[model samples]
Target: MKIDLSFKIAVLLVPIILFDTLAYAGIIPEKKRIIFKGDEQQQVLLIANTNDYPILMQTWIDNGNTQNVPSATVSPFIITPPMSSLAAGEIKGLRIIYNKQKTLPNDKESAFWINLYEVPPTSKENKLVDNVTVAMNTQIKLFYRPTPLANKPEEKTLVTQLSCYGKAHNLEITVSCKNPTPYYISLSNIELNLNNHTYHNETQLDMMVPPFSDNSYRINVDSTNVPQQVNVEYSFVDDKGDVHGVKSTIRID
Candidate 1:
């Protein structure tokens, strides 16, 4: 009886190559939204192994707005259990702690992201070993909020000065919300009412108006279908950095 050395080597390399590809693509985190505030700066994220086999999971944090991974020393936050194994149907906690010495500014909220890589565990079973292992990675948004010393203004006050309008000369529906107050405003649940039609675009719109800054969302519809007025409806984050369901409507002509 004889065995092929080349075939054995190719089988071994396949899993490794697949795992590396998975790590590059990333795994999905359990939590979609992560808010860090108050006296406690540490948060635990629970990740579950929904697969039938064991998986090795690794985690790291990066700037949410950027695709590049952050530097180890430059990142104030530390990810515990940078690498761990998860059994089938297992759930584990990944602790993320923020170093108080390198905390964010007290005036505004900052954004970061947690990414995970999941790889299949090697097995002695011939069937398991023969199967091609595919790895995956997921990234979730992480918000770091500074504990304000003084009470922040109400959401209405923070957004009362918001102005939403339409461009009579152009094909775009413009939503302009200027944050006149010293508090930051996260305008979510945004819907634009134009040309007697309502447009509900959830994914493409991420509006955050910083303190004393002018923020606007330009929605390109069509100049031929221009409306007489534009009505914008949105929700904002409260003093505790929690998004409030309260809705505010503004008009633009």
Candidate 2:
């Protein structure tokens, strides 16, 4: 990642909210997530400046750490034009080239993050205070697909392959799911029905299960009567960020 202090950019891990006013980031990526094939030499990401004013942009690749700065992170991929200035309503492509020095897992898919920093232009009136502008940082998931997995079924199809089971302990019921596919599965809107009762919450079960991994969530129930079986309903986010639903039944273990 290249840093240009001349722009007087101040990077923050979280969005800056000044009193009642919110600082909106002007840059938008064309895709919600990126899939990079090992056979390809490079992957390109197109971003646009939606605001009426020009903004400075900085990009970097990290190992899924939200607190990692550009200089502290290391990865096999390099983004071209790490730092640049975009005119208002201008669209530009960012080239991501793999260095090939780092050996990633061959059988399973690897994951990384693409971070973009948008620095708005400093107001002339604020320049008297040293011309510092707050920058908004955004990150998206990037999956590296080796050549071998290219022939397999799409990730969306693998949603049906997930196996789940339920177990009750004390006043809580635990639901565990196993993802056998090589691709990661991002789940949301998880709802479990047991004994004619539905257990669902806004912040309870949203998670991403890694390849060949298991994820479990516990839901508290008031009744001591635990059901022997459960119906699991969930939704997964695709590469395009569209949500799709899935239903399955699991027995208590």
Candidate 3:
């Protein structure tokens, strides 16, 4: 196992609010994803309750692939506060810690899920209200970067494989994120430069491409103008608190 350079990753948490005829719940966060690594082994997520009454939120980390499923055995690498209660219009910090001493693969990145289940103040007693009056639990991907034992993959690898071309039938242009390498690619801000016009995704999708995966998004712009190139913005957090942002471009022609 080899320790690589450090980076500070930024996860974008968005705002969410729930409204029902009988109840209202809110959990507003700055970002959706969280990165845990190196000396900065912990990240604090600020959660705000915009509701009028108190709400009990259960916090935990689960494997990234598995969803809201409950497991008898818990994950040992990440630790989250068991639970928290927020009053009306109150905000609280949920500290997530990555155990430094724990043994994890140093060759690649591992992913997990962070869950915040908002239990209605009267959930236990009024179970029937769950159908229409309760807010769904919030969850996002939590990534862990293990020290790389070998040469790290480059950002150009993702950029080089991207493409934008129109389909023969519908002429809808599809932008692709093709990953030929073994490393997973977390991608964002994929902008297409066509003829003289440019377009980009507004909201972050938190899209990731597994090794050798073909991922594509359809651009709603005019496909008649052949795409010239694409500008991509990718980022990750190092073991230190530094956040590395890489901007790379790929020519479609």
| Cα error of candidate 2 at position 210, Å | 1.4
Better of 1 and 2 by lDDT: 2
TM-scores of all candidate predictions against the true structure: 0.65, 0.79, 0.56
**In candidate 3, how many Å is residue 41 off?**
7.2
Prediction 3 global C-alpha lDDT: 0.56
lDDT of 3 by residue, 1-253 (tens): 1211121111112122223211233665434566556346677777777566788888777765433454542554554567788887666677788776665555556667777678657756577564555655677667665545244545555445543332322444555666665455666545655566766644444456655665665555656555455554444433232345666665553
Q: Worst lDDT window (10 residues) for model 3?
A: 3-12
- After superposition, which runs of candidate 1 have C-alpha atoms over 4 Å from their true positions? 1-31, 70-73, 119-136, 149-169, 181-184, 201-206, 211-214, 223-228, 235-253
Model 3 spans > 4 angstroms off:
1-25, 29-33, 38-46, 63-67, 71-78, 89-103, 122-132, 148-169, 178-185, 199-205, 210-214, 224-253
Better model by lDDT: candidate 2 vs candidate 3: 2
How accurate locally is residue 39 in candidate 1, as Cα lDDT from 0 to 100?
Answer: 61
* Model 1 TM-score (2 dp): 0.65
TM-score ranking, high to low:
2, 1, 3
The top-ranked prediction according to lDDT is 2
lDDT per residue for candidate 2 within 1-253, as digits (tens), equals: 2323321122221135212112355676656788888788897887767668999999999888777889999999999899989998777779999888887887988888888888888877887786656788877788888999877575557878888777878777777789998988888666777678888624642377789997877777666687676777877888777678888777876
